[model samples]
Target: METVLGIDLPTWWFLLIGALISGYGILDGFDLGAGAIQLFFRKEESRRIALNAIGPVWDGNEVWLVIGAGSLFAAFPLVYGTILSVFYLPFILFLVAIIFRAISIEFRSKEKMKWWRQLWDISFCVSSIVISLLLGLILGNLIQGIPLNAKHEFIGRLRDFFNPYALLVAITVLSLFMMHGAMYLIMKTEDRIFARLTVMANNTSKFFILCFMATSMATLIYVPHMTDIFKSHPELFILPIAAVLIVLNIRRSIEKRQYRRGFVSSSITTALLLILFAMGLYPNLVLSNADPQGNISIYEAASSTGSLKTMLLIAFIGMPLVATYTVFMFWTFRGKVKLEEHSY
Candidate 1:
């Protein structure tokens, strides 16, 4: 195997892509989660505060998703095409949801009419839920294995994306997002709204814990392949152990009224969970059930070694710039949101 900087090109790109996704999940996940439970804030002021809390950074956060998808396409065109083609319908819905979520955020404060604001609030909440569910569905299918033909294409029926297990994963993801969002609200609020959000945060945390436990049990009992790495290399078990502790820390931090710490814990938990997923799928970018031999390994699906080397150079230069921008933006927008005449 040809190596660049002590690692194979394909493996390096895989790690690169995964890191981008982890960035997306941590950055965008809370905003989506905040929107998922928007209707819970009955007062107009409460809703405004919630919306403003994420307003400044929500759009910037989605850049990670765009970058992750583009990186996947650039690094492994075959895997990109095959997976997108497999779940085309959900992708279409996810795209629409993203557009509408942005629209709702912008248009909600454009008018003072009750009906107008109410309409956009519903739009924002539902679209956020849809985006989260669709992401989980795609990830679930990847974990459960897809029906891919010998030609490296999806051969499953359109409805295959809605399998029972996939739906369960959807529940898990939505619940987790809601919890993450609540923590963000708690961190960015004060007064009665702060009190209100703390209660919601605690409730959503329990909801997420339930969904996550069920999802984990289902994966262990039904999706045995996902755990194979842990079985073969006992050291891999540390990922799950770390994820569990982080989840507990989220609850403990919230109980201690440490909102920033709780949010950090949630972010770390998100990264650990994705790392676990990557560990399970390493080497194989997409698995095939229709034809057992049709699996698209990283090496098989990746572009030429020369192309990957070039991409590695671009990624090394580009990602740090992106990270710096994200950090600067968040630091600039830090603190509780205050609604003003210019505020959205």
Candidate 2:
């Protein structure tokens, strides 16, 4: 294994990949949540307001996903090829949903016809819901383990990816997104819409809290090796503890009417949960259910030392630029959305 600043190159890439995906989840999640609940807004102004809240920056948020996938290809081509092949069906649907989401955002306001707007509205909401659900399903399947052969091939059927636990995780993710979206809407709204979004935010938080608790218990009981690191190294228990504390603080901030703080807490909670998830898998990027030897550990699946070094250097230069652009975009679009003659 090659070391970069005392840490192995493969491990660094894994952490980088996890952080990038977590960034995507946190950034895109609120917009997805907002779209998921768009139909509930009733009035046309309310729906337009919710859409505008995320309009200026939703597309930029997806850049993280592109970077994540690109990094995986550069740093661990084997894992990229194998996991992607296994997830081919779901990924295809995910792409379709992405296309629909983009077009819905662009085409929704193109016409004034009620049917035209309704059609795009449904497309936007359904696409957002499916995208979020599919992301959670992929994660759940990864945590539960995929059936790979000795050659690192997926030998399982599609049904394996659609198990009950996966669906449960998907529901929990969707609920969390709803809560996150509600918080964003509350922050970017006023008067009646603000009150409505606030109430929904509270309700969604309750829903996610229950689902999260159930998922945690189910993982302990049904999912194997998930808590192995925590059980062996008691110190690692702090990760889950911190995650719980962050989740709890979300409600506290909401109760205090600090919507911005509440949203930040939720964002941190999302990142924390992802870190804990990465902890559960540790050295293994992709786990195998049938044979432990079939697992794709970070070292086993990483690129050559020279390639890793070169790619890492590029990442160091590139990621900061991406982060800066994201910060600038959000900062530029900060504060509540006010629709004018040319609003989304």
Candidate 3:
């Protein structure tokens, strides 16, 4: 169905889901990345400080994930069900990681036993890494597309999920998150830790930048006709070009020791990457080399027009409030985490 603005309801629904996922990546990506790196914070006090840096904001950051999922269920139930069913094990593992991390975070502080706290710390770090990898895998699967039956249901065994292109995509995303998280650590912490984090950020960002470019080129080469989208629509190349410029800026910012600016630049690069991805796959939500017509387009997977319209209205009204609250929470908690000597 069409909207008052002249666009179809399904278009808006797709836009909503895209925005939610992008927002989640930009917000929670750092927190999860930080948690992953916390494993290396060998000193118990250092680990505690790292945890404190994200403590107040992490829960709020996760809201974007909830919003993204809710938007998918409400606006594009078909896509949601297909994805969940197709990657059932990965999704389950992701959920388990999130749950364990949350539990460990809360319980870690309450436990006075050194071994107990260490166990909790390990759980938090390991879970973060798992969740981040699973997220990347999910995106990889989408890019590679799943095996769909005549009924449009995914009908492949678990082994089908493993492919060169998908694996590359997963590695690229994992590296991106690691860099993003390191940049955040540089921005949020101070003293020697911050300096160390800055060095880590620089190294990881360079490595990931190379990996991203390499994987992107390889994806185009390995996946026959994968570059067709860019070739047919040359305008789409601008997104990646802009992404490269942003990455350059991130490097310069880091070199200058402008941690905040570096973080922002990295985020912009991430945004550009997401935008390019969305544009590259436009019209088709999922694409498969095996079955050309099995492609699931946004139009085919969206909810009913009336339902989409109603949800759009509600989202328009509520999304700003959510954004406001999120920003306020971050602002309230803005500061470097101090060592125990400075603790209240």
Model 2, range 53-79, lDDT digits (tens) per residue?
Answer: 999989999999999999999999999
Q: What is the lDDT of every predicted structure here? A: 0.91, 0.91, 0.79
Which ten-residue region of model 1 has the weakest summed lDDT? 152-161
lDDT per residue for candidate 1 within 1-344, as digits (tens), equals 78987998899999999999999999999999999999999999999999999999999999999999999999999988887788888999999999999999999989999999999999999999999999999888888888987887667798887898888988888888899999998888899999998998899898888888998999999888889998889987988999999999988998898988998999998899889888988889998868978799999989988888888899999999999999999999998888898887
Candidate that beats the other on lDDT, 1 or 3, i.e. the better one: 1
List TM-scores for all candidates, in order: 0.98, 0.98, 0.94
**TM-score: which is higher, 1 or 3?**
1
